[model samples]
Target chain A: MNNWFKILLLSGLSFFTLGKAQEKVTIGEKQNVFSKVLNENREIWIHLPKTYNDKEINPAKYPVIYLLDGEINFEYYTGLSDFIARTPYADIPECIVVGIKNTERTRDLTPTKSQKKSPVNPEVTLFADSGGGENFVKFLQEELKPFINKNYRTQDYSILVGHSFGGLFAINTFLMHPDYFNAYVANDPSLWWDNEVSITRTKEYLEKNKKFPAHKMLYVSQADNEEKQKNWNSDMTQAIEKFKGIVEKNGSLNYKHTFFPGEVHGTVSYPGNYEALKFIFKGFRTDIKQLAKNPGLLEEDYKQFSKKMGTEFFPSESYLNIVLKFMKSNDFKEPETYFMNLKNKLYPKVK
Target chain B: MNNWFKILLLSGLSFFTLGKAQEKVTIGEKQNVFSKVLNENREIWIHLPKTYNDKEINPAKYPVIYLLDGEINFEYYTGLSDFIARTPYADIPECIVVGIKNTERTRDLTPTKSQKKSPVNPEVTLFADSGGGENFVKFLQEELKPFINKNYRTQDYSILVGHSFGGLFAINTFLMHPDYFNAYVANDPSLWWDNEVSITRTKEYLEKNKKFPAHKMLYVSQADNEEKQKNWNSDMTQAIEKFKGIVEKNGSLNYKHTFFPGEVHGTVSYPGNYEALKFIFKGFRTDIKQLAKNPGLLEEDYKQFSKKMGTEFFPSESYLNIVLKFMKSNDFKEPETYFMNLKNKLYPKVK
Candidate 1:
C-alpha cells in the first residue's frame, strides 16, 4: 500500500473502532453557561425526552424542570420523568430536565450568611460562605432560563426542584418570586438554616400578600431522619413541621406536605421528587382503555385539567401516535378514526 | 497546504469535533451475547457502580443483579441502585446491573405455552409464542451469567429481578433452581398464567421439598392496578394473594410481599423495584456517627448480618476509606485509627 493511503486507512479504521467500541446508554448532555450574576461558568445537565428528536413527530415544546444538586440527581431524576411520562398512560407530560451543578454549594443555596460550629468538633466552623441564594435565583431567571429558552423548545410552564439546602433555596425562591415557576418541590429542605430565617420570610410574605398567587403549586417532602438528626442538636424536623403548619393554616397556596417515615435526608429526594411530579400533574393520566369507548372524554379531561392548572396542555403528537397505534392494534375502529381526526386537527400535515 | 496534509488535518479535526460535540451523561453500555440455549443473539445493558474503576481504591467485587425488561427499566433501575448504594449511609452494597433486553418477549418470559383472546378484539390472539422461559433461564445460567462473571469483578451473591411475565419467570426460576441465585425479586408477577400454573407449581414444590431452601431470599411486590385489571377479566390479584398466603404460611422462606397502592400495571415497576432492593438488603445501613464513637460495633454488625445472610460481607475498601475520612475530618482520632487498622486488616497493602 502507498504510505499516505496506509496512514489514511489506519486513521479511518481507528475512527470506526472508537465509534463502535461501546454503545453507551446516555440520559443527558452537559453544557456550560456563564452566569454574570454568579460570575462563574456554571455547568448544567440537560435531558430531553425520548421523542424530542424523533423525525416522525413535529417539533414540540416541553415543561422544563430546574433540578438543583445536578450531579447527584441528574441520572435517576431524568430516568424517572421519562418513565412515568410514557404515552397512553402518561402520569405527566414529557419534560426537559435541566440539572444545575453547584460550584460553591453552601455559598449559593443559603439565604442568609450564618455559621455553626461542627457538632462533632466544636472548633470547626461550617457554612462560612453562606447566603447567595437570591443572587443564584437571579442568575437562573436572568441568565440560565433565557439560555434554555433560546436553545430548546420549551413551554411557558416550568418547575423548580431541590433537596436540603437546594430545597431551602427553592422555598425562598417560591416566597420571594412566586411567578418565576409554576410549581416548586423541596425535599428534606434545610429550613432550620440560620435559625429558621425561611420560616420568618414565609410568615412575612403571607401577611403582606394575603394569599399566594393562584396556579402556583408547592410540594414539600420531609424525611424521617430522626435517628440521623439525634447525632446533631439540629431542629430540622421541627422547622419543617412548623413550615407545614403555617402553609396549611394559610390555605391559599396549593400545597402538599408528606412525611416519608423510612426515608433519610439523603434518600428522601428519590421518592419525594416522584410524588411531587404526580401531585403537580395530578389530572394528566387518562385511561386509554376508557378512551376507546368514550373518545370525546379525552378533550373534556384536557380542558378541565387546563382550567385547573391555569395552563393549556394539549396531547402531544407522540402521545397521539401511541394512542392511534393502540386503537388500531385493538381494532377499535371508531376510536382509531376519532384519534386520527384529533391528531390531524391538533397537528395538521404541512404541505 | 498539500492535498494529503489537508486530508489528514481535516480527518483529525473531524475526530475532535465528533468527540467534543456532546458531553453525555451515560449510565451504562450495551453488549451482545449469543445464547446457544435460546438459539439467538441477545443484547444486554451493563451498568457498573461509580467506584468500580476508581484508581484511588482497590478494584472491588460487586453483587450482580440480572434485570428483566431491560428496554423499559434499565435506565432508572441502574440509577436507583447507584443512588441508594452511596457509602456512609448506604442502604445496599454497590451492585453490577446487567439488564437483558428482549428478543421475543412473550416466548422468553412465559412458563407455559398459553394463548388468550384479546379483550378488545376477540379475533386476535395474545402471547402466541409463549413458554420459552425455561430456555431463557438456561441461557442466563449457561451463557449470560458466565459471560458477565468472566468480564466483571463480581461477588458470589447474585439476584434475579423481573416484572409481569418477567416476574413470573423470576418466581418459576426460584421454584426450579433456588440455588442459582442468592435472591429473587418479582414485581406484579403474572401468577395467573395458564389457570395459575405457578400456584400449582408452588404447592408441588412445597409438598416435595417440605420447605424453601434456607439462606435464599425472595421479595414480591403487587401493584393495586384494579382499574386496569377490570378491563380484562384477570385473576392477577387473586393469584398474587394466594401465593403470598402460601409463602407466609410456609414459615420457612425468608420472604416479603408488599402491595403498592395507586400504582398502575405500567408504572408499578419503578416503586416495586425500589421496595424490592430495600427489602432484600434490610440490614445494610449503619450510622456513620455511631461508628465514630464505637468503631468496633461495625464488625459486630457485619458479623451479625453475615450470619443472617449466610454469606460473609466485608466493608469495601471504598467504604472504609469514607469512614476514615469522616472520622479524620471530625477529629475523632480513636475511631479514625480503628478504621485505619480495619482497612489495613481487610485490604492490605500489596507492597
Candidate 2:
C-alpha cells in the first residue's frame, strides 16, 4: 500500500476505535430468561446498583423495583433511583431495578375484555382480546421471581411500578395476591377499564377480606383530559377518590393518592414514581443513632407503623443505621453478640 | 458456495439488518456534528432532548451545556440532565448537552505551568507542560461555537460547566472572555493553582479593572481536603469575597460563592450544578410576547440575568412557561401593529 494511503487508513481506523470507546454501553447481549416464561421474546433491562459487584462488602442485598413497560419507563426509574440513592435528603438504599418489557401489552395488562375501538388507529378492525392479568401475575410470581432470586442478591422488600394499562395490571395483582409485593405504584391506571370492573371487584374484596397485607399504594391522575366531559380531571379524580374510600373503609389498607393538576398523561409517570418513593419512605430518617438503644424496638415500631399505614414491613436506611449505631456505640459488646446471633439465625450453616 | 451455506449467509445478513432496525437510539454517536463550529473529528457524544426533531411544532432552541472531560463525565452529565429535567420540583430546562471529549486534558485545562513531579510515576521525572487555557478558549470560541450554531437550533444562552481542574479553566475563561458565555459554573475550582498564582492574578485583575462585564460566576468547594488546610474554601471564599468587595466598592458586580458543608470534591459537581442553575435563574421569568416583539429579548434576558447572578444561566421549564404565557396573552390582541413596530426596532433590515 502507498504510504499516504496507509497513513489515511490508519487514521480512519484510529478514529473508528476512538468512537467505539466513547459510545455509551447500550443493552447487553444477555437474553432475559424471564421473557421465556411469558412464552415470548422481549428485552428486559436490569440495573444493578454500584455496590452490586463489590467482593469486600459481603451480605449485600438490595430492594428490587419491578417496572412495567420496561422499554419506555426503565430509563426514567433507573435514573430516579440512582439520583435519590446518592442524595443526602433521600439516601435510599441501593435498589436492583428489573424492567419487564411487554410482548402483548394489551393482552397482559388489561384486566377485562371490552369491545372498544382503538383510539390511535381508528381504521383498525374493532376487535378486543383482553383479560390476561392472571397469567401475567403467574409469569411474575412463578417464572420471573425465581430467576431474579437465583441471579441477584435481593432483600425481602419489593416494589411494583406501572402506568396506564400496566397500572390496571398492577392493581389487579395487588388485589389478587397482596403478599407478593411490598409496594405498588399505579400512575393513572385506566380505571375506566370495562366500566370499572376492577374497582367494583376491589369493593367486594375489601368488604369480604378482614385482614389486608401491609403494602404502599400510590394512585396518581393527571389534570386535564377530554375523556372527562364535565370537568377535565373529575372522572379520573372521582374514580381514584372512590377507590381510596374503599381501601379506607376496609380499616386495614394503606394507600396514598395524588392529583397533578397541570401534568398530562404521558408526563405524570416520571414525577409520580418519584413522589411515590418519597411518600413510601417518608418516615425514614437518616439519623439512625436515635434508635441505637434497641434494634428490635426500632423494627417493632416500624412494623406497627407499616401496619397502621397499610404498607409492607421493611427496614429503611435509618433502621439499618440504628442497628449499626447500636452495635458500635457500646464498644461492640452485647450489641455485637446480638447481631452475630441474628446473622447466624438468618444464614444458618454458613461459617 | 454450497446451497445451505448460501442460505445461512443470507439469513445472517437479514437478521443483522433486523437487529439494526430494532436497536434503540443510544446517547453517543461517532462523528455526529452538534454545531457547524463543533464538528467531531475525535469521538464525541451529543444528548438531544426528548422533543428534538419534532417537525409538527416550530423547532425549539435549547440551552447548550458543554461539559469538560467529556470522556469521563459525559455519561454522568447526560444522566444528571435527564433526571433533573424530568423531576417535578426541578425546573431546569431540557438541555441539549455537548460533551467535549479531551485529547490532552492537562495540556488544555490548566492555566499555568507546573514543575511538580508526577505522584503516580515518580521514578520517571515529569515536567508538567501547562498554561493552554487561552488556545483552548479559542478552539471553543471559534471552532466549536460555529459548528454548534450551524447544525443545532440553539438559544444564545450557553453554559460552560466544569469540575476541579476543568473548573479552574472555566473560571479563567470567564474572566478572560466575559462576553463569550452567559454563565460560568465552576464546581470546586483548583483555586490553589500553582501556589495560588491564578487566585493572586484574579485579585490583581479585580483591583485594576473598574468595569467588569455582566455575567454570573458560581464557585463551589468541598468540606474536607488536605490542600484546604488553611481553611482553603474560606480563604478562597474570602478572596472572592474580597474581590467582590473591591468590585462592589467600585460599582455593582454579580457573583455567588457557596461551600458544601460535608460533600467531598468528587461528589460536589452534580449538586453544585443543580443549585447554581437554580440560584442563577432564581427570579428570571421569560416573556414570550417580549421575545416575539423583540427577537433579541431571549439573548438579552439571558445575558442580563447571568450578569446579575455572576454565573452561567440555565432557564427551567417554568421560565419557558412564563414566556409562553406572555406570548399566548399577547397573540390574541386585535392590533398587531405594536408587535410589528417592536420587531422592526429589534431587527430593522428583516421586516
The candidate that achieves the highest lDDT relative to the unseen native structure: 1
lDDT of 2 by residue, A1-351 (tens): 343443355355532222223345442222234233466544556777755775533557788888899866665566567656652333456688888878788888887777665332344433277877788888788767666776678877788888888887888888888778878888888777777887998877767876576554545544344432343345555666677677767767556777765445555675578667766665543323223345465456556655645535455433344455545644545655665555444434435
lDDT of 2 by residue, B24-89 (tens): 425544332222222223334677776666553345677788888775555546655655555223
Write candidate 1's Cα lDDT for A227-324 as tens digits. Answer: 65765524888899999999999999889999998898889999999999999999999888889889999999999999879999999999889889
Q: Could you give the CAPRI-style class of model 1?
A: acceptable
**Steric clash pairs (candidate 1):** none
Shift of residue B251 alpha carbon in model 2, Å:
17
Measure candidate 1: CA RMSD.
Answer: 5.8
Off by over 4 Å in 1: A1-20, A231-234, B1-20
How does each model score on lDDT? 0.88, 0.61
RMSD of each: 5.8, 11.3
lDDT tens per residue, model 1, B150-247: 88899999999999999999999999999999999999999999999999999999999999999999999888867656756347888999999999
